[model samples]
Target: MSDQKTGGFIATAITSIAHFLTEARKQPALSEEAGYGASPNLPKPKPTLIPIMKIAPAVGWPEGKKPTPAKGFAVEAFASKLDHPRWVYELPNGDILVAESNGPARPPANWSFRWWAQDFVMARAGAGRPSADRITLLRDADGDGIAEIKLPFLENLHSPFGMALVGDQLYVANADALVRFPYVDGTTRIDAAPVKVCDLPSGRNHHWTKSLVANKDGSKLYVGVGSNSNVAEYGMEEEVNRAAILEIDRVTGVSRLFAGGLRNPVGVDWNPVSGELWTTVNERDEIGDDLVPDYMTSVKDGAFYGWPYCYFGQIVDERVRPPRPDLVAKSIKPDYALGSHTASLGLCFADDGRLHERFRGGVFIGQHGSWNRNPPSGYRVIFIPFTDGKPSGPPEEVLGDFRSTEGKALGRPVGVIIDKKGGLLVVDDVGDIVWRMRAV
Candidate 1:
């Protein structure tokens, strides 16, 4: 609910505490390893004082815009009129379900509690306003490339994100909770009221919510909770506020902490090869361009990636340092660092047997585009190739030219999934369109 900007006094205070903890935990290295003989791959230490970069708004695309040519794929419109579409899950019957996080009309500039309260009251009074959230079903009935929309399939949701279909049941992650609708073939209506699976903290506009994935056996579900404030606080209570991943039992609804210290893990997927969990995190903001790095990392149990303390793999954040000698020694660094402020969102492993063989087993990430840097970054989809369970190189642009030549953006991609026909389906919130990509 707090609309506090990043880098305010509260954020600075938290940063200071984190820095103190990191420094206090620094240990004296053995003589043999003290010299300039550290591993070559290790990142160099950064200075305490780093410059912060000012972020600019993105350029918007002209009306009726389309994607320019990319090397290996062609884009086709799948569906339109979607309101803030966040996630898309392909069902066994080749249908796709889309979840949208339509919320109270964009909060007023410099929002406050009083303004929000008034808005809520008006909304409840039926002030002739449109609904905030809903979900729908899309299908290509005749094997055509275009998808037809079936509206009102699921209605009256409190801004749901992260959807998955598991054998006769569809699970949705609503703001502050998880719900499931029983599946009935060829029908749009849910068989029964959604059964609550888990309760989470919601209502904050900045980090509303996103990304849910199930384990291979469907026994456990992983849900992402983004940070309440960027690098503001790290206390036990604050840590639980949308900064980690939650693992929940599918049947019992019991949930527990899966991983900690991710600023906003918007993109989460399971590595098909290793069965390990990987996430694309939107790192804390307000630091100069390139200070802290967003990452795609294999999340491990009880691992701490040092939000509000350290970032990327190892650079310590001085603002939030607070002398946690115990945590600094045990914090786990991320495996791969993407560029700062890419706003990475949804992630899925490429599994189709027909696309370029090079992309098989790689990861596809929807970079939602950056809002905290001078020149915006990540307005397209990129591929991270893996070989022998390791990254072969940096991400390559698989889809591009979603932004306008004048710096305006036409569409912002959030979620991605491989369709039944071995093509890729991408959800675009800005243009309210879902695009299907296949080899030409």
Candidate 2:
């Protein structure tokens, strides 16, 4: 049979097997409580021949519907009818920039049954859309907590995820490069051509979305580059300069690795109190549901956290060949765990105290949920309180009910940001809405 025939046969076989095997694996033995804070103990690995497939199918929210906010908070649709708004950036003037893009298509190199299955999951999760390649500006204009005017701020770009502004320059992190354009105060649109800052990893981008951040003085830019494969299954050579955070000099565009061994670092931020860089990392899969917990950590310069060879600091993976025990020995453990396969992607620190006291000084994370776990987790936005620059307590849900009682997804939270007025903004790609959360 031809390749298409083989692929079809395998896809059908896997689908048939998944129904029977969904209940074969055990539920989380320990409560998710055991998976947070600075010292998360690694659970014993339970490798599986087939991953548990329990995905919540994406279903658009009905009219006048929105996510349920935590007590003392209310949610309103800040803006609606967007084209896959995956990331949100608030300008100094309080204008919100929404990145309307998706994963760019690449060359069909490594087509297999697993690849097809992965694609299916993405489709059901509402991520298999073509890139819009534009950034939209939403303005409330009257401090009403709802955008009254919407404008296309920038257009004709690659798959963009992160945005940063320094002085007169507005930088946009596309899938394959970092580029910037001149920005004028109070201007709604940018027409100037973008100057390339540096080229990023592309093509077979297993982790395509590159999250960008800048230092306090805007002297350097930090780009989070995820690994090309789950555990370097495609060979170690393909991972050169990948799976690391590249620090770039803002003036000259020269880049160097700041940290490595992160499987997929999706969210990047600077802790306001400690003035340290932190990120949310998505760990490897197929090693059972609760084995390797997705975590957040303070990124140190010239540090390795162990991707293919080890995980969570010196826990051997045993799957890698020619394993260098030296590198594993140097891997630093993460600061806090966000649970296994939660797909924790968005991170932002809260310093403003205009909101409720409970959420005044904390870090809000957007967990996009997961399909690999049998009893699905993380279809919500959570808050991790911080005191004196460190996580002080376990995570608490800030927004929930994105997934319906019937196991259908009304939306999945992705990139999160704080509006200039101190309200929290969440990007729900599946529902194509930007939710504004604030004290009621």
Candidate 3:
């Protein structure tokens, strides 16, 4: 049986590669910039029978090999040789928390083209590692940028991602639920039991990352829950409370939907100047790479941004059925577009942090890089300048060189945060290093 299974897998692989190559030839390798800004140049929709799959093969950074910093800037390893770190958080007392985690295993499914590709292709992109299931603490005791002390602060978590501290309690957004533990300032370790806050969508969990943020006074927590399947292909019945941000009361643990129609809202932050909630969303794939550009938008109460039914302001997606015209009419357009298939994930406002004057009064984004577009986009950190709470111009590259000309990734940056000293910190999951950036 084992021999037969292996043979079948190899056969399928050969056939899929042939198909992928043929399809790649048919599609035009257009510039990703065609899908940027308020009025994007969205060409005619070109839905494919099978999605294009392109990912840079993950290769760890060579010794002394780091990303290229922007002009007048420098990059250094804040902490190296970590497990799969995905998210970062800072405490009141200047302690840093890194969620060293990866996706949990799913059960084996029946043989299919898309299923096979997802299993094998994602792994090639350095996403096949087992979950670390713990949060590590790093303290810069001597006020230097490098963290001299590193230790596990919380353990045995079920694929934790987002975290926020409210008063004396620290909340963690796990894959399946939101939980909290008691935290004290200047504490290096947390051995207490976690209190359950509320449940988050988890079954089959195609997009399981649950990012979180807290409002002023710590009265409510906003959680980002991604869709179970792209474009509701798995049926809307399975999508209850998914693809939306949920607002939970910190004291009562009660939850409600704050906004909807976001396919995969990952990073949520409040704009310091506007005091408005904002998020970076990952749009649906398999349509043309130029369609459905991922976006960053301010969250409005009871507002819907189109998901499976429509995109980019009522440009309907014909893939879905039953045609809810009413919903399409109500779909709100996003504020800014961040290139198609870029996989924009992390969003951090330039609040009090002073990395440099160029980064001031702007928002920093970490694009996780693309897997469906040729000449794949977004493997670097970018800054978008804002004038009076609105995006003023195109993104300026802050860090690059994550992808090589030979199609290999040295690192894939994930969550980004600013430290106490105003230095910018980037978490590289593929390289397993936390890098700190400073103005030279």
Per-candidate TM-scores read: 0.81, 0.96, 0.96
lDDT per residue as tens, model 2, 315-370: 99987887989999998988898988888999988876766666666899999988
Q: What is the C-alpha lDDT profile of model 1 across 1-440, one tens digit per residue?
A: 35455325544554465445434545532221111111113334343232222222333335667665357678887888776677888878787888866544544563654334334323322221443467788878878778765666788787888887777788898876899988877776664788898787664444667568888889999998887666664344555646789888999998888887888998888787787899988886655444355678899987887776676545567667464545555678777766666777878887645566778888888877665343457788878888766667666778877776666667777798888787788888776778888887
Error of 3 at 423 (Å): 0.9
Residue 338 lDDT (model 3):
93
Candidate 1, position 155, lDDT: 82
Comparing 1 with 3 on TM-score, the higher-scoring candidate is: 3
Q: What are the lDDT figures for the candidates, one per model?
A: 0.69, 0.87, 0.87
Residue-level lDDT of model 3, residues 342-439, one tens digit each, is 88998999886477666666898998899877658899998999989999999888888998878898999889988878888899999999999888
What is the model-wide C-alpha lDDT for candidate 2? 0.87
